[model samples]
Target: MTEQKLPAATRGPSDHTLRDQIVNAAMEYFSHYGFEKTTVSDLARSVGFSKAYIYKFFSSKQEIGEVICASCLTQITQRLNAALEEAPSATEKMQCLFQTLTVAGSELFFRERRLFDIAAAASRDRWSSAERYEAWLRETTVAILREGREAGEFERKTPLDETAAAVYLVLRPYADPVQLQAALDTAKEDASRLAALVLRSLAP
Candidate 1:
């Protein structure tokens, strides 16, 4: 393992940066306290802003949740691409993805995890962006697999779309709040196994 630098948000104009501050505070409040238990006021207090000020930034708690998660999702995808650059082989690339996944919860994105938990489910209660995010993940994995195949690092026999879809389904649980929290140690260990399985199945 190496000393990994956490991804830092690039500073933009002050006007646009304030929204990220509000989202950051909401992520903290929601992740530390369950979503249902957290109130808009709690999010406001977390950011040292008044409840009225919170409304100026967000229309509702749900809006805050969406903004917070959307940012985390965008950031995670960016970092995953960065991780790929540091890995020489396809297997190593996939393995580094787990590190990226774990960091999503470790950063200012914890409340974003709670949002992910609800978003991962496909049931009626699933958040609106859940399906869209899942689709994005599937497409990303598919792209990686195709790239590996082109590089002659992954087997030509494996169906890229199918395997990518399976990868998302398999990894979805660990991306959740309860499963990720309860199984952190187990997941850390199993991440190696997961990496091995992906390599064995996909290796050229």
Candidate 2:
């Protein structure tokens, strides 16, 4: 028989509201103490629950971290999708994509320094949610590239996959927390220049 997988909320809480409270408390704990230093007991106390009670929803602290990671990526995906929808042209959409990444990533990174470390480690370890986010990012980028080709906004002879990969790499610094923090004061300027260069690469 195939095993049944429960929904995130159902796995932990009797209803959605309590699950949200747990998640919010976990986010606060992890942000302040960093995930490695936070204990199940600590989070449980923060939520006024017993360790056993918290376990009803989250199997472990790592699971809580994963949930936070998934939530962050979901927000980024929504913002990207909204930008894509609002942009009148593929070129503008591509521009909006990087800009959105810059703004969103910077805000998160600035809020908690260790958040970047968690995401980087998850990415290196090929965590499922992180990998899923990357796949979505790549597919979305490829869609924009293909749209640009169809609209005569881009004349690149490279395959769409290669083009998307190249574009993602070139703009990595704008969205990478480590790099962004290094030049935090100049981030906007750097991203604007990088965006211009990326657009030029796609020019016919």
Which of the numbered candidates is closest to the native, going by highest lDDT? Answer: 2
lDDT, candidates in the order shown: 0.65, 0.77
Q: Which runs of model 1 end up more than 4 angstroms from their true locations?
A: 1-33, 41-57, 106-125, 128-132
The C-alpha stretches of model 2 lying farther than 4 A from their native spots are 1-15, 112-121
lDDT of 1: 0.65
Name the lDDT of candidate 2.
0.77
Alpha-carbon TM-score of each model against the true structure: 0.66, 0.81
**What's the C-alpha lDDT at position 27 in model 2?**
73
Q: Residue by residue across 1-204, what tens digits does model 1's lDDT show?
A: 122222367454353466778776766776677666788888878878788766766777777666555665667667777877888876677777666666554453344355543333322345555556656667767777787788898888757767887777666655554456666656666766776787777777
Q: List the pairs of residues colliding in candidate 2.
A: 12-57
TM-score of 1: 0.66
